[model samples]
Target: MAKIGINIATGSLQQEEMIVGIDLGTTNSLVAIIHPESKKPVALKEHNSSSLVPSIIHFGEDGAVSVGETARNYLVNDPANTIFSAKRLMGKSYDDIRKNASFFTYKVIDDNSDSLVKVQVGDKFYSPIELSAFILKELKTRAEHILKTPVSKAVITVPAYFNDAQRQATRDAGKLAGLDVLRIINEPTAASLAYGLGIHKEDEKTIAVYDLGGGTFDISILRISNGIFEVMSTNGDTYLGGDDFDHAIVMKWIREHGIDATQVEQDKMLLQQLRLKAEEAKRHLGQKDVFIDHVGKYQLQITTSEFEKLIDPLVKKTLEASERALKDAGLTTADIDDVVMVGGSTRVNLVKKEVARFFGKPLHASLNPDEVVALGAAVQAEILAGNNKDFLLLDITPLSLGIETMGGLMDVLIPRNSKIPTRIARQYTTQKDGQSGIKISVYQGERDLVKDNRKLAAFNLTGIPSMPAGLPKVELTFLINADGILVVKAKELRSGVEQAIEVKPQYGLTDEEVESMLMESIVHAKEDIAIRSLVEAQTEASQMIDTTVAFINKNREYLEEAEIAATTNAIDQLNQSIATGTKDEIQARIEALNELSRPYAERVMDLAIAKAMKGKKI
Candidate 1:
């Protein structure tokens, strides 16, 4: 009774409509879809091109953006403009990355304050969301070019340990790429799905996924029962992966040939060449007994045994992480029904053997490790589209439902493509001293900032007893009934004050408007990001000014005439910058104010402490 559509080019079956699956990996990315006739997942690739698209982005002198292999070539030539490993920065603040900032070649804007990290490229600022969107956009275009039809929706996979903010950022990246991200599933779950570990309704298995990618490694233990997959625990090193293996080989050559370390460090091109050659050697050793190559007239050779010996410690590190994951999951190797091997690094014979030995069983790696996650994503897409009977959520929310918080950011409670009749709740607190009220603004859209999204409804929960900032615990709840109605409720637990509102969250927009909003977000991503950075900086500056004024007013007697005059001047300067200055200028002024007031503030604190201890007991 139903007509099925098949993609003429790649044969992706369409049940009503087609949806693709994407693996947005840290080092590489790819797209996959279910084959129309065979009904099996396959990674899509153009003739003569590898399905793996390097997750790299390059900004040209003319302001054009390039992704994948083309961008990868510029990593050394134009390190300042090429962005890679952006996945590590998603949802991370400046303080989270300062210690390892040098790992990135590009300039990461460090405000020294806890703000979302950004990349400064040629006077323009870009967020990790924008950088990742460029890669997703490329994948979308490549899929469209192959399928000969528009690809507008996808299910993207993230690492099992990704938090709520990271997951939402990935969704926003998809929206910016013009894809209605159907879901953000865990990588381990996708890997299990790719291996058909949980496809059947009766299948019950506890699987472990060992994912060793180009630059990082993760081991996830999962529990699957009745076709539902849950990630029990995830553990791994963010710095250990194939890249480390390559570096091990590189260091070997350096020590063997007596090459000057300083020389290699000075010459970026030569260093990159050596690394590439090392990578090539690592891949070659996977298929051959030995790898023989040359990097800039220096002979490079490594037997499989030698290579294995060099990386045995690295492999053990993964096994250690697996044990930790198993321990955290409250399981053991004997309990794991299947061990799914993922990532190109797993293709190495030594890695496969060590993992199998550690698990006391053979590994499941029939599918291409690099493509497995994407293929699993295709299965998820099929399920989400109602093409598969094993899983069904007939009525769903078309867009994400979220509430706006401080700095005008949207924190999504119910993501897009979520099943209906969902109830979700998150806690919040006041941002200022003695604040007695909190406003909950509901929004529906895919943009990161609330201003770019459409407001659904708003309500205030007042009568909270005055308390210092962050002392009041306010809980917000969103309940979407099966009838497509949304009820937003807010309650201050300590004060027992509450408010509720019911409204149709999808009332205002047509399908065209939704698509246009996504397109507009992509078109104005740069401007929107710049404005957001400025607004965030201004907000921080304004708060600093207020705090500084309060301190001055309360402690004018403890301050000298010169100290009071200097503090006032700093406050006025910060205010002026907030009124009319760029994000960088505002941040700079805030730093200056903090520096100028640090001495006086410390002096006042010491005076108070001394007064308090003046006549206290020993």
Candidate 2:
């Protein structure tokens, strides 16, 4: 008799069969999946492991990396090499973060340019993207170990207020971690899904999601209609969250104990210990009326009421953000059908009471606030995998659609797996001085370089009035209709020069071929991204050199002989570095050049302004 074959490892299941959902958060990260037996979304975990992974990474003397709880242990001992809060650097330049640079203990490179920022540890330089990838890779490994299966595809959640560049950075990090990111959903949307708000086709509701995480806060207003979720508005302070709440307690403790704040600041180990104690006290106060503790000779004691008072201003700030979101959405508090709480901070009694009072309704706190987003992402992943047919799964673009930009980089307009019948437009500017025409080349694939992707069509937007670089504003729009046909349009707003083209995005590609292309993209994702970064560095270096040359030529009379010679030497070093140096080397030279030229440029600008006002009346 032929007996039924039984597989001991996976119970007849094959590896690489499940798609997980990931919450790539600022302070922590987690992965979840739909349980095969229960048909419910659950965060993947083991008896010895945890659902949440502290989003931290540390580099050792030997250049080995550690992540999660293990890496978190290095916060005090190896603060310089232990990285946290890297998410704040995503898609930001040095100028954007200069004011807050003191918050980080590690050295953040200040190039004083518009180029993306980098962090330095010892002799190595790391971008936010690369740091974030280390965290993602850890989560991926954890999920795979827990599931006993290879996890390749994922649905990742981001803050609703993240701009296009921030979202793209997140996608690149996921790709670098060897995961094929199927969808990039908003955190608030994922929270709503976890509460089953948009699963029914006939359901219509408006909800407010108040997400207060460890390091950031965001309030998003969303409307759900017929299984579709749309973000109406979002408002919040990226630098405010539960961390500040803990800080309040720490300060109060220091004041009561007569401890020197400066002394605490100088001792990293003491500061980290106090922070941990403050966090512990906060959690204890959540369940009890008061918390009392001691650190050395300092006695820390606080009542729930006092804690509430300490955070009242912070809570008020959140309410103000929520008010702004509601006003931006053109809605009143009464229009909100549900109020969902997300993040561990929302578990505080004061937060709950204030949120309920403001909304005029009891909050939806039934679900675990910390894990709601991850669970919701799992539901979306299930839908993407066709495991949940009861919910509507909109048609998605088979591959990423983008246009070629300077340096031959494929700037994605619409990412893969985006819902169909969508429209998006972005503004662009000329790269060359007095440029009159712009070439728009559309492509379809996942690679960073346009040459690696399949070119769909090419068109030139001619007749644009000649304008200086960065002067003329050109709006490019991509509209994908119901039938999956793409219409690309370009309009120079200043000149009113318009051009458009229609193309069937899926022309000549079979389903098998599409799958093959996707697999190829995932397999080569790392190298593609590395090449893209190098090319971007090269392009930026070239632009800086050109700008410096133009400035020197135009202001030859204003510069001192020594200043001109110094600036010229710096510019030459930058050019040479661009030729053969690493990305970090090129960036270092760029910083040197900028440092030498900034004061001169400002002096010239002041002179021009003074001359213009010389004979004018006040």
Candidate 3:
């Protein structure tokens, strides 16, 4: 007897696999796929329902997880347990978000360290990766339900200005959600693809993508040739978007109604309600000339002219960013063949007029702005699956390449899916004073820690002149040839000591073996991330303990007994936490120790400076 695979939901033969395209957006998310029958990209949706899914997550008292419209309802009544705008938090540290911390309604832990930030709800801590995973999982489930097939592979889109860490975080989220992310493409590029800008081999054109999403705005200049799209330059304010337009209305209403600003600031629920009203007004003014509403004793009315005037400054900001992008790309507005508008906010009449005036051309917004990216992603997925043979797809590296650095962290030199035959160099330093030798261990994977990845090769560069730590510069260069062979070279700049190694990155590996390795990596993605975080926390704690002990021993005479005792106690607590506690617990203890020692360290530096100045003459 032969075994036949079948889909339980649709009773169809599960023979051909489907790869989906996903728009994991800040305000909303959705999935799209190429229709096998029509040969067109269409967003997956249920009967008579819209495609957009609110990118919100809510945790209930029973520890049940909810997403989309169900979770959006909890924003006002259970704000602390709900997470939104998680894309803004991706790959960011506490210091990165300190200035805008109040923008979030939930608690964001402030450990003052350089590690990724975490949100606290009740007693549970969640990283931005985990939060985003919930959204992706929701989209995956929806695609599976609508297509009646098991969806496992996807191509996700991101902003053109997103850094490497942010892109990696998105990939990790997809893996955690049980999706094998085949590629991470720029949202601007995806938008252009949806408009059929890069499908022809002879089509040579320069285009501009002006995207104004719910929480961010960016303008990108791109050049397309022979079905290849390359971003020339990108610029925008990550903190400015349509949300600010709503905020402008709220401020205007407060001024007109003579509402107590202090009272509104103190009441989160009331503030949320006003924000919702402002959003409604913004949407209503798009089609009507005026909006009228009353909440409590305050009557609010906003006209189209007033709404346009309030957002003029923001519109001008986008134009300025466009000018800068053009300047950086060394191209004038005349060089652009087309200008594309993306995001729901672009539907505003004023925005369209201003953008047209700036570019001196009509806009390309024929498709729904909210769904264009997902549609393009679906097209890219089609190409990846070899179903669309008209467009040429370039070869890409299968895994990330990096070297082991201090604290056992994997500092990526070349990210995965990068164009082939590329070379990049980075500088590193010795961690110990008078260190004469350095070991270069190369690894391949997506994990932050080197231990969780596959070791490719290792070499040692010896003979460095005795110098203080961080004085010796070691330049490491990675070059991948046309045949996918990697050559790693390391050289001590000051001493002229060099070492080199060659490894065939794709040697002796069958296609099935590679697939198995990819599957295993995705299967263990969450655990790998957790282990990496714990190791980093432990490394930081150990380093802090050593430094504090050394400082106390050397400056005993400058410190009071009570201060020394407190500092010692804090160090002891941190060590204990490092032994058995979670990353957040260990980080909290480390922060406590820093708070206890910072003042004394500053005082000691001040006294030393004073004594030195006393002996010297001006």
Candidate 4:
């Protein structure tokens, strides 16, 4: 029988039921189930007992695929088939992808996808949502498998810097993955939850979370007291992160080694190898004073001092962002109770040292930096489930929600840092003589020029009884919900005719575009699965061969030579089938290979048991 994995269905479950909280990070993702009784959040474990799944999805040639840890292993070798760090591209355009092409290991292609960046993997294209859904789906499965029940309600976290379109895209991805996204919590806020969950004081204390993750950076200043978390201010570079720091290290490596990587893009394999090398050096410098390596054709050894020197400028950029966040919050460093460090990037010794120098206090990383956001999310889930009665979180909009005015100036309505579930009203007048309709363009950003910011949507104030210039008065109000989605409405003040404005986001997927993308993804899902399964089957076959080799040494007296020969033959056939990228053949050979190695697996288990018994006897 072909096994099928059951997924958690979407929507609100029974009221008072425990809700799940997810940290959908750029480098990794985790799902935690809140215990209704204890109000504790437990990170869900995979089928094989691993938590904290890597945010990677590998597409195979057969109608089979793998995600998370198994998929991340295929990244360096099958860069084309494996999509990693796609979180940065969600809701972004081809133009944005082009600007940071050098930082990625995959091929960012300009395809016929209506100006949206389409990731070309081998011969197929995948939208960012589809890729992200695969990751989300994997997390959902892990949670369902762990709890033995469906996890319907969840709060997903995103970078505070994600714009309206990006947040919408994230929610859409959650929907596609069949999870009811109760809320989209900002990453920094989630970190605060992890830090301040059990603390409730009468007086408020301002805390800051400096979250520099794999593909994005965010600095959020939050105020907390008596279980209320109010995000005071937030600032970040959406496109910046630890990946950029690694790129700085890579460029330095090239200069120190006298090798040029500007031309390495022509050779995708070498580029992939170099990126892996660069990443290793960056990680190494975290623990050691020096790094030594030969990354394919390039041979270079870099001292920690040299690497730090190269990345000092990038670190400075983060400091500048932190300062901006503090200024935005109208607070000084002394006002902060603690500066919390979240994200694996905080492991960098230099990052910690510099943060301490800037803040005049040693950075706090008491919680698992990688898991705090997810843990905090779990706390939110508990609160949402009515289990944590004392908790209430108030997340503010990261960017000013506004509209384009005359001469392309931004007419901000609801400024950044405004509390959620708030509304602001603005009055609009007729543009010119006898103007029948007033076209209103909505934008979101801190930019002074409309062109420099993101165009959220545009709608018209119509049915204006065509009066002479300056005679009509139209009232427009932008209401932001708790979810942070903007709702715009306009009313002809004199005529009392009101119409809800429908504005299309500049880089957002329209209804038709989304439908087309789903169809395309469905059609291509099989091909991608096939390619990935072929590689995975071969990898499995190789591991089986190694295990058999070890098993034969211990059980040679009990096994027949022909049994060993058959196992070897089956593995060879599977390896050969993997190269052909034939899904059916690979599946058949893999099954045969697994069958042939079953005896050896059992024998190895027996041997381990016998050794344990011997130890007990001693």
lDDT for model 3? 0.87
Cα miss at 520, model 3 (Å)?
1.2
Query: What is the lDDT, from 0 to 100, of the residue 528 in candidate 4?
Result: 37
Sliding window of 10 residues with minimal summed lDDT for model 4: 7-16
Top model by TM-score, which number?
A: 2
TM accuracy, model 3: 0.90
What is the per-residue lDDT of model 4 for residues 1-618, given as tens digits with 9 covering 90 to 100? 854443343322333344788998888999876654455666677556656788988888884679988998787777778888888889888777676777677877542122346576655556687688888888888776666576655789987767766776676577567665667778777877777633454647778899888877788888876666678888878677788877787777667777656676566677667777878988888889988889766677888898788778878899999999999889998888878899888888788899988889877788778788898898777766656555554565555567775556565677554557788887777646567787778876544456756677787777788786557888888987666567899888988878775443223546575445334433444443334334444554455455556667767777778987887787677667767745445545655666677766677678778978985855
Q: Which regions in candidate 4 have their CA more than 4 angstroms from the true location?
A: 1-18, 35-42, 46-50, 63-65, 73-81, 93-98, 101-127, 197-203, 260-267, 292-300, 392-461, 464-488, 491-618
For residue 302, what is the lDDT in candidate 2?
Answer: 94
Candidate 4: lDDT over CA atoms?
0.72
Any runs in candidate 2 off by more than 4 Å, and if so which? Answer: 1-16, 609-618
Clashing pairs for model 2 are none
Better of 1 and 2 by TM-score: 2
- By the lDDT metric, which is better: model 1 or model 2? 2
Candidate 1 residue lDDT tens string, 95-130: 988888999999887655666787878766777988
